[model samples]
Target: MTRFAPFLLLALVACGDNDPRYLISAPAETGTAGQVALRVATLEVRQVSLPAYAAEDEILREDETGALKPVQGALWADTPPRAMTQLLADRIAARSRAQVAAEPWPLSTPAQALVDVRVSELAARLDGQMHLTGQFAISSPDQIVRERIAPFAIAVPLAGDTPAEIARATGRALEQLAEQVIATLRR
Candidate 1:
């Protein structure tokens, strides 16, 4: 019984916190119809730069006091930077005629235009809205098109306070950003 007691204790110690972790993913569908014509034939989307809090694995919300707090047991399914860059690239390619890939661009030929996005704020606020504000720059490597930097502010109403709702709103906000980028590329 003494030998069995040690094993039982080990088992008990191994049984760590049993909290159910929810993995959140931002959906890429923008719900907008029709393909946009792009001046660039191919575009490269660099890894998205997220704020320290937004880059964390935990899903965060901005409290009434303007503090960012993580939602318990909720986490991003993929690395935030990579996931967001890929999402933007996919969304842009889907909505436009240009071929898009997230950097490091995997094509033999160089991309005509490169897009870099730096997100300053990405959080669900106490006002029941998910806010995404950032600046995106489009640079032409071969000098094919005009280079430009654009600031974007997007907010989507949260359906509920749950982490899932925040994730959905985040997706919506990103979709709007993608649309804006597409519009800029058309010029």
Candidate 2:
């Protein structure tokens, strides 16, 4: 027992260190200046789907081989899919000035339009950029024809190599992606 005292003490000290928890939230809502008037009345946003690596709670970084590695001591308050879905919902609602409901659509009736998004890549790259690449599909009850799927890729340069900077960059990338989706819907 005496020989293991130092190891035990070290373990205790390491456990006491406070690890910071970060939140990947929607970028601040921006005005719809110069945006086209909304065409759809009500929009329903489905839960954003993410790849297995991105769906993890820990923040991930992309390696050169296109693999993801979790950043040490870095974590997200929520999973990527759930967080991105909330962001998309808020952004669409604000930009289009339309009623947007998230999954489990809490309405008595179906929405006029439905938005489905899938994020295949969402991580900070070794080159110091936050990347967000995904595809979105829009379906409307009013459209007689089937809608085509739209794909988008967004990258925002990181202020630094720190995890906090990565989080901010990720938020910016998400906002840009949301803006693109809103634009496509307007068109």
Q: Write the per-residue lDDT of candidate 2 for residues 19-73, one digit (tens) a residue.
A: 5777775456567764455567677889988888888877778767977878888
Best TM-score goes to which candidate? 1
> What lDDT score is found at residue 162 in candidate 2?
69
Query: lDDT scores for all predictions?
Result: 0.86, 0.78
Runs in model 1 with CA error above 4 Å? 1-33
Q: What is the TM-score of each candidate against the true structure?
A: 0.85, 0.81
lDDT by residue for model 1 (41-119), tens:
9999999999888888888888778888888877777778887898889889989989999999898999999999999
Pull out the clashing pairs in model 1: none
Which whole-number lDDT from 0 to 100 does residue 107 have in model 1?
Answer: 88
Mark the regions of model 2 whose C-alpha exceeds 4 Å error after superposition: 1-18, 30-36, 63-67, 142-146
